[model samples]
Target: MTVYIDDAVHPWRDQRWAHLMADTLPELHAMAAQLGIPRRAFQNRRSGAHYDVPAPMRERAIALGARAISRHTDRELLKAVIANARLQYDATA
Candidate 1:
């Protein structure tokens, strides 16, 4: 079980953001709590269960032990992580 933060740095509302996902919902929520992100901020979409972390917080997540994954470089692992996240969402839903 591991937490993954992607390098998808998309810009929104003038801040860059990335997706924070984990092998399980509990792990995902725990990391979000550690980052001071409220449970309400969790994105529970069918796309994938995740927390959107801003650019600066992305670095903090890495420092706190979240595995950094790049869509460009970690295609397979990223897919597996996302698949697991979607499964987690389905289980809870």
Candidate 2:
């Protein structure tokens, strides 16, 4: 499974944030662990299941083997990743 980190363009708290997702929930959690992110930070909402990562964390995630995706350049694949993430949550919830 592949872990994906989108461009950190969501602005909040004076810093940009991005979504950290994976092909499956387990993979997603594992990557989050590697990134030193707590499980409590997981966002399991209906919008999509993912972790909100900071801009700096985006580089770390990429270094740790996450595939970086840009919302402007990779719209279609990003949508698929998001759909898969939501499916994982839906199946278990």
Candidate 3:
């Protein structure tokens, strides 16, 4: 299960943040845990679970096997994430 973070870089609330996502929620959680991110920090997005990871955490996540996305902006990334969620949701239907 590969994990991808949207945006090569982003700024949020004074500091930069990146959108982190995975093919599955469990995969996402496992990667986040490896990066020492607390479970409470998980961001509950309509497109699976996401987390606005700081730059440092983003880098660490990448180093630990998460893929860093650089081609799309936040909106585009969000669209993809949502699509993935819809697919997952539909498969269960």
17-78 per-residue lDDT for model 3 (tens digits): 88778888788889888888899888774455576788767778888888777654456766
lDDT of 2 by residue, 1-93 (tens): 899999999999999999998998899999999999999998997777899999998999999999999999999999999898877676455
Whole-model Cα lDDT per candidate? 0.92, 0.92, 0.73
Which ranges of candidate 3 are over 4 A from the true structure? Answer: 72-79, 85-93
Ranked candidates, highest TM-score first: 1, 2, 3
Task: Enumerate clash totals for all models, in the order shown.
Answer: 0, 0, 0
User: In candidate 1, what are the lDDT values of residues 1-93, reduced to their tens digit?
Assistant: 889999957999999999999988899999999999999999998889999999999999999889999999999999999998887676455
**lDDT rank order:** 1, 2, 3
lDDT of 2 at 1: 80
Instruction: Show the lowest summed lDDT stretch of 10 residues, model 2.
Output: 84-93
Question: Candidate 1, 81: how far from true, in Å?
Answer: 0.7
lDDT of 3 at 88: 46
TM-score (C-alpha) between model 2 and the true structure: 0.93
Greater TM-score among 2 and 3 belongs to: 2
Looking at model 3, residue 37 earns an lDDT score of 85
